[model samples]
Target chain A: MKKNIILASTSTVFGQPYLSYLKEELEILFADAKEIIFIPYARPGGISHDDYTAKAAAFFKEIRVAVKGLHNFDDPISALQNCQGIFTGGGNTFLLVKQLHELNILPTLRSVVDNGVPYLGTSAGSNLGGMTMQTTNDMPIVYPPSFETAGWVPFNLNPHYLDPIPGTTHMGETRETRIAEFHTQNSIPVVGLREGSWVRVTDHKIKLGGPLTARIFEQGKQPYELSPGASIEFA
Target chain B: MKKNIILASTSTVFGQPYLSYLKEELEILFADAKEIIFIPYARPGGISHDDYTAKAAAFFKEIRVAVKGLHNFDDPISALQNCQGIFTGGGNTFLLVKQLHELNILPTLRSVVDNGVPYLGTSAGSNLGGMTMQTTNDMPIVYPPSFETAGWVPFNLNPHYLDPIPGTTHMGETRETRIAEFHTQNSIPVVGLREGSWVRVTDHKIKLGGPLTARIFEQGKQPYELSPGASIEFA
Candidate 1:
């Protein structure tokens, strides 16, 4: 089976319903999938796993596909192993990564996706599809055992990437500055996936999707943009 | 010796010179001190330790206090143990925490501050004065050994705190929402210190300083505003 993945910057764009922006693309990506295993470890505002899962389920229902929360399974490892498709929703990356590591199924989840099961991720979920979660914009509300994530792609991701607001006085590190700091400590390339943008993978080929351009950061080099439909491979 | 400390939200406000806003307060805080030990580990924008220290030194020069970087001393523990005054400049909290833990000087730094060393922290430095660094608003560029900090105060500090913008398209977590998430995971109260604001601790009497009101977040409770010069007690 060939790999089919869509790692999006956000589940919902501003002034849009959740997952509506990607409706057409997802209809094709999950064409053959009978059901999607939803991992809701990252939902924010203190939303519970079941509640988060139900929210995803409600969205997928419009497409006539069933969605099941990974937590609902008696054996999550087995559920991942047998699931036809997977969809991880957006929330806190640290909390998601921590829960996945603690459940001792991070490797299983990674392996299943690597085996070519159709996968979809948004925001924090998209971060998990990268080589590591080091470039995540989420706060370290909880510390994960390791910063490692699924290495389905060669590079790391900076989801919900925003350009510096001009004439703004906010002193917090901008998304670009933060990614630059990550390069100082690690050599991994980072994809600053903007809202409505995503990285689509099919088999061995990977491409940037959506209308916007994706920002690319590498060690010792100026950041550049990868236009939509361009390959995401790094040197 | 009483705990005479100042944990500021930022070293420099938007339109002011670095450390100038706290000039009068700092002079009174370090009134009897000879020199101040400067921890430049948190300096941002890819600045070096020596350069960061020099910047801090120039600021303290007005007060006739010599600022020395902790990296310059062969024995940082000894230098910290005997320093009359201490100032940890702001930048990246994770980087500072990582360096302190790697050097195995975290305990010593905490001990010295707890023993009334007239400690001063700004931004990232202020985050370290809390019970833990989990509430920091910094990017985790590097993973530290632990989320622990100096615990100089009973609660954590969220420096450079900003309220939610009224008409923004950005979907990232607001400072208030992020602090609410922190409360879900931990019980420590978090003081959202706006830029130009600070927490002043004179022994057991802790107060919010500056003109702006500090936002306070406690577990399972609605966040509220704390007026300047108001007591910062959680209960």
Candidate 2:
């Protein structure tokens, strides 16, 4: 079965326009969908389940879509089993991954998507769909034990991308240098996404969204920038 | 020819008690020392060569010490090869490791110690003597091109350890839990050391120093705490 997956770069509720834009995109992708399964368990930033549910309810009202929070749904596998579409709201990617891993819902989540239930993720949500969660800016403030992450997408995504600070003389290396170091040790590709931007995946094809250009770092070759609307084949 | 290696946690200027303590420890370790070689290139926290040299000059006044920063020495390996003792001052461990890895000095440093050079490390300097640099709380504020680290000690050291916050309700796990998680995935043990505390190693025997207790985390076993002066065999 064919399904749509939306990966958002952030979980800030203040970004109403971005959420609206994503909702519009998902609506077009799942035109015949009658309900949207909102997974707010990824929000570990002290946001209550009621607040998340209400936010989703308000956003999807124009489509008259039924919004449901999965916090009380202890059985994530079963809850996600027959869902028409899955939308992952963002907060802390590491926290989300920790819960998913602890509950053993990661594999099941992948299976649900394989069974053709569309998946939508933002920020932390989008992070889960990547090969590894090492790229997120969230502090390892809390330890989930292992750095294991879902390997849905081929490359790691660096959300909230920014350039180097001018005239900073700290002994530590900069973010770009760190990412470059990661590329040196690992062969994984990294996608630096800016605000209001996302990666749209359908039927195994990945395309860029929004107006900013995404930076790609690979070994031996000079790092290149990909403008929005650019498409790349991931093997 | 037995040599001495002193690994200091911080690079101290003249008249600093910490620097004097380090020198005293080195003197005791190498009672017959004729010269002391200083490796100040390892100091990366905006510490200039002259600044470190001046610090060394003050210490050398009272004792028979010859300070030679690695950069000024004709052949670092040769200088270390025939030195009576090598003193490594600290600043940023990651930066130190990055430079050492780049110049391929780790293997030689290890060899020097294997040849009976009593090696000592403090703070970030002490971190380089561990198997992995994962435990260092230094911010990955800047990214180096690689995570390569000096693999001296069998376990990773978490220097400057702090307990969990009293009333904060951070969603993520605490530092202890995180270290445990690291053990689950990797077999390496993590030693959580607080300031003023250190682990003294001699011929593969590790002794806890200072007043703080060192916590050890391993897979499947409950985390254990070791008091100061507790000794463990580490290769």
Candidate 3:
């Protein structure tokens, strides 16, 4: 049997109501699983290991929860190697990538996922499953030496989709405009997920969630929208 | 006499009127200097060394312009050892920080400034001179191992400040709000500079620039605005 993997978008314990929904979904998805290894080290927002572990413990109290041993990257790798499922909580995507790259866990992560470890990601965690970490809103809290992402799920995921600012000529482009600019430079499709919306990948199929629509942009094409329950074939 | 430093906020040769102002300012500042060194290697937006050099050459045709000898961080340090002043162009701040940190030039750059070497930073270059590169709008194009910034300047500079977005429930914080958040966490004051506005720093004095008012925020106090020509004492 393939182990499960869950990647969450945000590390805020109770910020988004959808987190509970996601937790419930994972419980149903991995009902037969015996152990759940929660990895909260991805949060680099100054939260300590104990704090993150406690946060996970609070949420996963109903389940058999075991916070992943984070003495170092090797422990996370070993946990991945033997665990039934892995859950990655989100905080800052860049910070998480920096840690993953520093510890050289990105390659191992890919291997486990390819071996069919059911991976789950929320916000920043969901972002790691994509091709690039360019869409995150977190400040570049740290430099990670490289921008190469996990590339597990194809395309870029823009979490927390927002509209453009009015009447402000800010030097930097807005998130939406930035994504559009990315499409102009590259031919990759981008999925903009609003709050409470998510994408579920099972085997070879990708499904959308919540009432929000996923904005899709492809090169040389007009951007389109996808509603909840819509399944997009993984390309 | 201390060597002069020029920091710019953008590299768009055209389109932005501020570029011309930067050019004029550079001409006036470097007029008396025997030679001017162009540090185009800091343009990390995939701008080729040749192209960067050529752009600097085209801009300062009459003046003796020499591209800094250190193309990447691997070259000899002597390239910038005897320079009159250094001008850094703008691009993606994250990319610039990534390269500088990788080549280990950040500390050396800081040393040059400490030794009284004149420095000029535009856009991403300007962002580098500040205490942290958190305020930049550049997509996290690359991840370096840490978020440590080139603490050349004491405050965070928010170049190209803009107004808030309209009627959006999903409003993420504006640039000002984001900077305020940083101030809440760190005591450092954030200076919001619109295009064409820069802080001229010499020794201990910091002066504001044209038309736009700079928003200065400190912890435990309401944010205030600084009009152009207002001098701030940096301790």
Candidate 4:
């Protein structure tokens, strides 16, 4: 069987309830699953793993899908192997990647998802599904053993991809500049997923979803936009 | 000799020539030195190290101080040790830190700067003088062996610190939120250095320099601002 996944730019949008923006997408994504196990490792602080997981549960409750935090399980690998569906909420990619590496479960997470377990990821969680976390916008609060991440998707992802505001005088490097810098050292393609945008994968097919056009950055090429439903094909 | 350093928030403010914003400050910092060695590792792309160094050389020329790129040196460590003064121009912090680690010159750098070789740093360069580069705003395009830095000053730095725009729906973490997350994992202090602001150090004395007030974040405490010339005292 082929892998199934939905990697979203963000779990929430401006002035909206948590996960409310993706309500329809979640319902369809989790249609056949009996239960969804959440990995709340992205949000390490500001909220406890159980508390963060509860937030996901509340949302899943709306869709009538039973959900539990992966943190509650003694053996997370085993739990993931037996789960019907999985959701990884967003937070700091560094923290999430570190935890995944420390637990020695990156391989397990990849294998199960490859075994056809449906998966959903938002923001930092979505970054983990990409080639590397090096393009993350998060501060390096902690160091991970490596910049490598799950290669569920062929390209690295810049979640919540923002455009440079026209009138802003801020001297900080814009999202495009940072990713351009990333391209200098890496050959992998990058998708600049705007808010409300997502990458939907069915088996070997990958397509862009949402109202906006996602920006694409590849090594040695100018960034261009891909319209909704456009295929994000890779070799 | 006491450490003599000027760590500016940026090389240039918007609408200003490179390093021109800190002209007066640099004059005082490098007054006694006949020449300044420039570190151009922060800017890894878009410009060559030779070209980046030329920019710095041009700025130093305006002040009538001879400047040379560290890249031209056969031994970066020895050149830094014997240099009358040093200047590290800003670009990407991750690249700067990674190069510093790979070249095995971080310790040599810290020792020389401590031995009282007058030093000037802007943005990524300024971040190198901090406790750690974990607080840097630059994207992690490269992974260094370690996040540790020079510790020329007690606190970490967030260069090009920007205040959130009054109205925006963009959900990317604001500069404040990113630093807040940093506090969740580390106890090191962080100074949000806005454009035109800098940290001045002389011997055991540290003070906030430049026009704007800097936002300071300490562990388990609320972030607050320090006015110009205010002592940045630390134990």
TM-score of each: 0.98, 0.55, 0.69, 0.98
Q: Write the per-residue lDDT of candidate 2 for residues A1-235, one digit (tens) a residue.
A: 4536666565433325436656667677567668868877655434676797778777777776777787767676788886777778766555677677778878878877756677777777787777777666553333443445555667887766656657633223444665665554457787877666788877767888776688776655577888888885544
lDDT of 4 at B76: 92
Task: Report lDDT (Cα) of residue A144, candidate 4.
Answer: 90
Q: Which regions of candidate 2 are displaced past 4 Å?
A: A1-3, A11-18, A169-172, B1-235
Candidate 1 regions off by >4 Å?
A: none
List each candidate's DockQ score.
0.68, 0.06, 0.22, 0.72
For model 3, the docking class works out as incorrect
Q: What DockQ does candidate 2 have relative to the true complex?
A: 0.06
* TM-score of model number 1: 0.98
Candidate lDDT scores, in order, read 0.90, 0.64, 0.65, 0.89
Displacement of the residue B12 alpha carbon in candidate 3, Å: 10
- Candidate 3 lDDT over A1-235, as tens digits, reads 2334443334333345435756677676557556656556555445666677667666666655444534334577776777666666766665678778888778887787768766667677788888888777766545566767777667778777665656655555566656655553466677887766777776666777665677786666677788778985434
**Segments in model 4 whose C-alpha atoms lie over 4 Å from true places:** none
The alpha-carbon lDDT assigned to residue A127 of candidate 3 equals: 83
Worst 10 residues of 1 chain B by lDDT: B134-143
